[model samples]
Target: MAKNLIQVIIAGGRVVGQAFTRALKQEYEASQRAAQRAGGGNQGRKSAANDTFTGMSLQEAKEILNVSDITDAEAIQKSYDHLFGVNEKSKGGSFYLQSKVVRAKERLDIELQSHSKQKRTDQPPDT
Candidate 1:
């Protein structure tokens, strides 16, 4: 019957869709592992910290947060807070955007700390 044929086609389509999804997931995970392996070593911590959880770069994070001056912590926090609230899932906003805001804040914080540390180290000893 046509009904039986339709059912068989639907089932086949679902199987193909599931297989494609699984393959995509496996490929993504493998790529992430390879990136981690490549980033390992002396500069790993700094490099990893500079990147967002979703692999966004420092410049990208800064742009997302609308930050121009890395030393302006207050401005960065204000922008981050506004964007985070705007993207809150409970306010009919997207969880993905909310997470990106969070990751951007984290990356900026790391950069701020690294900057301050470098400044301290670069300064001559106090008399």
Candidate 2:
């Protein structure tokens, strides 16, 4: 019986194997969607650095940065420097880490600038 099954699979060649693979992939995708809907998927999870300026959730980023309690500019800068330094090592000569650091800095700077502007605007103008 096993021999017969093996022979049949071999006879079906690439087409049958591909069909099976496609079906498995579809099932996997469906399960992933269901998981996401249940809030048990990684799709909504944000890395620490991603929370900076890409419109990702700040809470998630703070958690990733491990500095959710610290909000000072100097502290944030120190954290950024530390994270960038760790990511600077190129395991595969890829510059992905550096790029991410640059993006995070840009986002932080923009946020800080906007915040300062808001603060200034809220003040009473000199008579």
Candidate 3:
């Protein structure tokens, strides 16, 4: 057998006393090598649609409000209301959750405005 081959004992969903130093080290090294090959340029990376709200990222805000359609104000408002309603302090809600809901709504509104303006600017002026 090879030295790399490790014998893990069988158990009922439990990892007994064991050493995985080699595995972890190998994983770390592999990740480092991959990073090096990818040009290590993390400066100009654009965020994904589902990343954060305007401040958090559009994706995060949407998730917070349980909204998937970014351009639909009605849907976003409805989702925000539902969440905010459920988290109202008077209704046994957490201040933190209510605040989060508010922020998400604000972010979505800003995003929509920005998107609308961008579209307007992109269109050719009346000739």
Candidate 4:
């Protein structure tokens, strides 16, 4: 084997990690879209159906729920509960607004679950 046969050893780990992150993000977005499509099955209420199950970003969910910290589950639930109750259709609220509240809570739940999973994975295994 020649001593200097290879002038440079390329480290592609970072690139691979970035690509994997992008792919994961795309898959998550696709799943959200599919859920939206499946949930929008109401044919009569065109506007309500269209408004409900829309693709909601993480930031949008945080804003909708007025959540300042994503890790604070209690605060998130409190905000969600208040907004949900306030948007109840029987309480003279718009159905569209209620749907948005539901979606926002769901998006936040997804984020919390992912954060928990990441934490679990980051821990070292017991001997």
TM-score of each: 0.60, 0.43, 0.56, 0.57
Clashing pairs in 2: none
**Candidate 1 backbone clash number:** 0
lDDT of 4 by residue, 7-125 (tens): 32223666778899999999877656654554444422332323344467666788999998989999999998898889888998878987888888887776677678879999999
Per-residue accuracy of model 2 over 1-127 as CA lDDT, tens digit each: 9999998888888788899999999988875654454345353322222342365344434544445443367866787777777777554433675555555555555456656777899999999
Q: Candidate 1, overall lDDT?
A: 0.82
RMSD of 1: 9.2
Evaluation by lDDT, superior candidate among 1 and 2 = 1
Q: In candidate 2, how many Å is residue 118 off?
A: 0.3
Each prediction's Cα RMSD? 9.2, 10.1, 11.2, 17.5
Tens-place lDDT digits, model 1, residues 6-122: 999999999999999999999877656654753756444465545635477777788999999989999999999899999988899999998989888888887788789989999
Better of 1 and 3 by TM-score: 1
Model 2 TM-score is: 0.43
Sort every candidate by TM-score, greatest first. 1, 4, 3, 2
> Rank order by lDDT, top first?
1, 4, 3, 2
lDDT of each: 0.82, 0.59, 0.69, 0.73
Per-residue lDDT value at 22 in model 2 = 99
Stretches of model 1 off by over 4 angstroms after superposition: 1-45, 52-54
Which clashing pairs does model 1 show? none
lDDT of 2: 0.59
